[model samples]
Target chain A: MIEVHEIVKKYGENNIVLNIEQLYIPKGQCFGLVGNNGAGKTTLFSLLLDLIQPTTGRIVSNNIQVNLSEEWKPFTSAYIDESFLIGYLTPEEYFYFIGELRGWKQNEVDEFIGGFQDFFNGEILGRKKYIRDLSKGNAKKTGIIAALIGNPQIIILDEPFANLDPTTQFRLKFILRKLLENKETTVLISSHDLQHIVEVSERIVVLDRGCIVKDIQKSEETMQELESFFKDKISLT
Target chain B: MIRLLQFEWKAFLRSASYNTHLFIKIILALAALYLVILFFSLGFGLYFILEEQGMKPFDVVNRVLIYYICIDLVIRYFLQKMPVMNIRPFMIVNLKKNTVINFAITKTLFSFFNLVHIFFLIPFSIVLINKGFNLSGVFSWCICILVLIYINNYLNLLANNQDVFLYGLISVVCIGGLSEYFGLLDISRYTSPIFYNMYTGKGSLIVLFLIIVGLHYVVFRFYKKNFFLDGGLSIRTRSVHAGDYSWLNRFGTTGIFLKNDIKLLSRNKRSRSTLLISVLFTLYGLLFFSDGLEVYENPTLHIFAGIFVSGGFLFTFGQFVPSWDSAYYPLLMSQNIQYRDYLNSKWWLIVIATGISTVISSFYIFFGWDAYVAVLTGAIYNIGINAHLVLMGGAFIKTPIDLSKNKNIFGDKQAFNIKTLLLSLPKLVLPIVLFAIGQNIFNSTTGYLMVAGTGILGFTLKQRVFKQIEKIYQKEKYKTLKAYKAQNNF
Candidate 1:
């Protein structure tokens, strides 16, 4: 479980992004964080990962405070941006390096990464091509697969489907479902594609500017209501 | 065409504001140039004083002008940038080929070193004409200086454009060997009448000027034809995982950092070239060391000689360590790692580099085993003193350096503040002062032993000093970062 209490982030003198009160994310649930551009989705993600310090807040996970525990780091995996991908190494080498960092044996790393051979359509593994040379969609696929390598309890993906092709997008959705079913991995995904977010996520949270505007769970009539609500809100803007 | 020149000038000046240090350096360069002119005038005044005592002024002035022209040729060759700057932009433009070529040739005139022809040669020409030398003589020498400058500029551009360094080693060997062989045969003198006549005073200045002009035209024509061709900037695509190093696992983070550091250093042309040049200079000193009375008379000069010989490793190795990670420093900082480990890794790298250099330099110790031992002693002192100094300097002196740009070894833009100078002064002056003190305190053998003992102690204690410095680095990280960013515009 992840808990954020009174998180506030400021750039210079202005509090451009903020989190009021408290929020909790239970284990084994898919949470879709939907926000428009400049809506603090990335900043919030950065804060959770401890990449940047929050102006004022307490973040806790699994009875351990966020900044004080190595447990939080080991169980959490994030791909914030393309910069997260080390460009100098081939996909295979990069995967192996990340696996080693997680203390995985060579045989284990190779075996696990080898499972993605078919997923990549035989384009990535053992190709001896740097990540910088890979196309945007392929690079994203590489990042996602690497994050899943150690089977972390929580995976945070930012804009995972933005640059992917339609076929790849469908495949990724299926892969996420399978991972959820098997490992009960709690996934937090941020996206602007409302239709896809609603389809994949069990709980949807709407963020406008920096504050959480609405939180809803998917139900029998919730999808229809969400579609109408989203349309009204966008039209009002 | 004039508008294009104006645009180029505006763009250049606008880019200068990108870094405050770079803007200050440009101003400093202008002041330095003015000082050089003032020094030259003072030397001319001294010559006038000497010439009044029955020595011929024309001969002295002529020799001075010739020497200046030679130095100008070398300086122009190294500093000229017109060929690359002009040709690159013209490659994709709709401008006519001849027009582009004409611009490139004319741009050579804008180089500051070309002004030497006007300053030195023209003034000397007036003196020669007043002294009743033939007008042809004055004109010939002036034209010769101009032709020499152009020849040097064009040759340097051609060589650099063609990736000449790839073939440079072989070319040097071949030329050296051929010159020696021809000198032995005694028939080499007949092969080129120009060289023979130049030595014998039969060479006309017109013939020399015409030959250089023809060579310039040929080179210009070649560049004009291939200016837009993609031969020069071809990116080498390679298989990324060509070699896998399983050994990296054994050493952990240090191994990873070292491997990555080496890769970054090797991939960057500027950094790698600087390292190579430092090694080459070490070898030059080793090859040139001589035991002479003139050099050893002053204890200060002796210690200075020792420091200069071993100082290259410290000066270049630690100078750009932080800047090498400028692009990805934020990422590195975010990782759960200690600042001490980062500094320790840098210290070890300097030790390794300095060790290799000292081994190479030991071969040229001319004063027998004593000189070799002194060099070894000095090398240890340099490692301890200079390495600590660099870390201490890094803690306080915050100057952001762009790793991508090539910086001269003694460039004015490098952080040469009072703080850095004070930090460096102890490294340079203390060893000499110690050696002098040791010499007075004991017999020659015991004095040498004292100096060597102190060096060993310093080397051994370097780690302890580095740890203290690293603590300071951690505490002052934000201040250092702020100062670093403040020095740069972006």
Candidate 2:
């Protein structure tokens, strides 16, 4: 479970990028955060990862206060940006490094990531090339696979499908669906792709400017309703 | 063509203009060069007026050619080699490579140092000719000097293309060895006949010109063929193991910091090079002080100088602590790390480094027990003093350094800021003052023992000094960040 209570973040005087009040993500649910560019999605993710400090209020994850502590960090995995991937290391090396950080043995890491090998079509694991050399889709795959390697209780992904091809995006959706069926892992993904969000996420939150303007659950409404709602909100603005 | 030149000039000036620091640097460079030229020109003018009574016509003509050749070579080498400009970006445009190369080569001709060569050489040559030396003799010497200058420049370019320091050492050794061999064997006497005609004024001027031109062509051809965007050293890509040093688990934060320091030093080329050079320089004292104190009758002065030289490693390595982390400082600050732990890591790193240097210097200590004791005292004093000084200086100093950019050992850009210099003053003065006061108070052995004892005391009190510095760092954290960004013009 993740709770963001009245978080406020500012760059300088009067330049508040995020102003939000009370957002609770229940355990074992897929939450899709949708926003246009510069709608504070990345800022919120950064705060969640403890990459930056919030100006006010607090974030609590799994009963532990969200801080830059090893305990809180181990249970959470996030791919906020490309820089999260250490560009110098190969996919296999990065996976092992992340595993070691989470105190997982080599066999454990191999076993965990080995499951995603079929999905990657034999392109990712054990490739001796650096992440910088990998194509955009393959790099995203590498990041996603590593994040999922530790089997963290909570996972956050920012624009996971941004640079991926259609085929890879479809494969990723399939993987997420499988993850959702487990009912133990909580996933928060922020993306602009409404179609994919509608398909994978159980709960959808639409953010405009720096505020969450709409929240809809899949069980609460049909897919067409949410689509129409998003269209109407965008046109009204 | 003129428009292209204007565009290039605009770009260079604009880049320079962005940073007030770089603009100051350019002005300082120009001023320094101007002063050097003025001094040399004054000396030459005095020599001509008083000794030679002005230059002869032939000497003037010969000197002009020599001057041009030397100036051209130096300018060409600098223009082609300095990676600062990175003219590779121009290659992707509609501009031809030849045109760009031509522009670059032409820019070399405008150097003030090159102009200085012309001023001094031309006047000196004229005076020599006026003093009744034969035209051929004057011309031969001038042409030889010209060729020598080109040879020097080309050699430097070749060395710059390779590792600068490694090739510089090789070149110095080669020149020293060759000079010694020639002096001993009189090999020049045997080869004199080959150049006898040229020296005697019978050889053609066209031949000399052709030779110089051919050398220039060769340099250009070599550079043109091999000089791609990434032609020099192959970039090494290493697999970084996260949490690789589990041994640090014992010391907790200190251990983690030490491990990170080790990883950083190993991964970054500048830090690694600085560490390597520190070791090398510490050992260099051995070569100088090998003979023992009796070699210099006054053991006190010799020991003092030895002590100063022995402390070289710490001073050089400690000076750049803050600059090393400039690039990743934001990430470092954002992490929930204690200020004391960060400073302690640096302190420990210096201790480890100084310890290694002290052990190496122990070899020289074997020559005499007194020398051993003196060096040990100096090393210990430096370690204690520098640990405090570096931490304090790091807190106050706000210079941000990009370790990725290749900098010279004595580059002005990397040299003393007010904070560093001010911090260094006490380190310098304290050692000398301590040594002096000790020498006045007691016998040499007793004084040496006291110095050594005080150094030990300092080492014990280092943690307190470190804590004080850490408090200062915490207090001025934001200011330091601002300073760092300001210094680098980030």
Candidate 3:
């Protein structure tokens, strides 16, 4: 679970990027955040990870104030961007590195990656290619897989579907569904793909210019409603 | 052409680190002035020194010219950055390829290497003229040397990849030295005549002029053929090597960190150069010890050489602590790792590097036990004190290094910053001062023992030092992350 209290991230005077008064991501929830360009989704995620300090407030991950203590790091994992992957490391090396940090043996790390053979599509492992040399899609897959190494209580992924191919995107959805079966793991995924998000997340939150506009549970009409909301924004502008 | 020049001017001026660039340029100007004065003095005294030794000054200059040329090339290879233009922008714009190429070539002529030779050449030529040599012949000889310097400028284009040129130069020197030793060939006998001819007639000047022009054509054609981005300008990617360093896992998390550092140094171009330079530093004692065995009598210079011999890695690669991970710093910061562990791992890394360096420096034993002990004491001092200081200094360094960029000794902006310059003072000065205090009060053996004792004290209290360093790192974490993010724009 994660809590955001009066989180306001400002670049300079008069530019308030993220100003969320309160946000509570409950345990075992499949949370999906959707936003347009410059919607401050990444900024909010960065604040939660404590990569950047909030101008006015703080973020608490699993009851630990992320800014005050490093305790939350053991239970939380994130794959925000290519920055998550070491450029010089092979995918297996990267996985083993993350695993070692989370107290997993090399063979145990091997077993965890083995489960994602279908997800990796044989392009990542045994290729002997550094993450830098991989195509964007493959690199994204590597980061995402590495995040799942130690089975952290909470996993945060930003724009996980952007660079992925359609097939891999579908596989990622399946992977999310499988992750949610545990009923204890909280997966936070942000995406531009409304359909993929709608199919995967039990609850979806629409972010518009740093404000949470809609928070709805998945239903038969959810996809149509979300699509029409985005459609109206294009016409309103 | 004017527009292209304007673009370059604006790009240089508008860079994020323009102030850093300006400061470095001022420093470089001062250094150039110092070098000019130094070379002038050397030139003024060259004739007198040679006369004191009862040798012909002109013959000596001609004979040693080949060595000077080789040394110049080696220096230029490390220091000169190949003139670059963002040709990709011009490729789609309304610009001719020839014009762009010509601009790039012309820019090379303005390099400091081309101008630096004039400082020594002009003063030495004046000395030659004062010695009652023919004016026209001296003029022709100076012109020939200038032409050869230009030829070297163009010849350097083919030697752009540093490793190839460095290895080639070393081998050439070794082979030449061996042949000369065995009396198979006298390179000076052959090379001396070439420069002597320049002083005797104008024909060699014309010949040297033709050679420079030919070199220019070759370089121009080479650049022309590989002008496209995919052909020449594309980033060179080496074959991926995934070496298993799990053997290092015995030390636990520290081992993992060290393995990653190893991979980083071996795989990345910039870091690889740092590693190479560190390995070479172990032999730094050669500069002093090669002069004479009497160097052992001077504890001050011996201590200085010893510090460099083992502390090369600590000074060179150790200063850039978290910046080496600047590319993925956020990931490390957010990972399930303690700040103490991270700093401890870096300390261990420095210790291991110093240990390896000390072992390599054992070859100094052939010089004497005193030289070996001096190096050993320096290594202990580095591992104990300098390692902590360098890491602590690294906490304040927020600049990000582009690890993929090929190393240019003088081209890197981060290589010479005010913070690093200030930090280097204590790292280099403290040990010598400590040893000097003991030497003045007691004797040479007492100096070594006292310095070694101080290092042991620091080493024993390293845990306390790490606590303070970790606090600094924690305080500066967000600022460092912000700086890296701003520069990388990701």
Whole-model Cα lDDT per candidate? 0.65, 0.65, 0.85
Ranking by DockQ: 3, 1, 2
Which regions of candidate 2 fall more than 4 Å away from where they truly are? A1-16, A21-37, A48-237, B1-85, B88-92, B104-161, B164-268, B283-318, B322-348, B366-374, B395-404, B408-417, B443-454, B462-490
Model 3 Cα lDDT, one tens digit per residue, A112-216:
899999988889999878888898899999999888888799999998999999899999989989999988999999999898888899999988898889889
Lowest-lDDT window of 10 residues in candidate 1 chain B? B186-195
Tens-digit lDDT track of model 1 for A147-206: 787778888888888998887788778888887886469998998787778788889887
Q: Determine the backbone clash count of candidate 2.
A: 1
Error of 2 at B255 (Å): 6.3
By lDDT: ranked, best first? 3, 2, 1
Better of 2 and 3 by DockQ: 3
| Candidate 2: residue B416 lDDT (0-100) | 40
| Deviation of model 1 at B231, angstroms | 7.3
Candidate 1 local lDDT, B39-111, one digit each (tens): 4565345446657877766544443443344444444433455354446666667877777777766776666
Candidate of highest DockQ: 3
The number of the candidate with the highest TM-score is: 3
Fnat, one value per model: 0.12, 0.02, 0.78
lDDT of 1 at A43: 79
Give the least accurate 10-residue stretch of model 3 chain B, judged by summed lDDT: B406-415
Give the lowest summed-lDDT range of ten residues in model 2 chain A.
A80-89
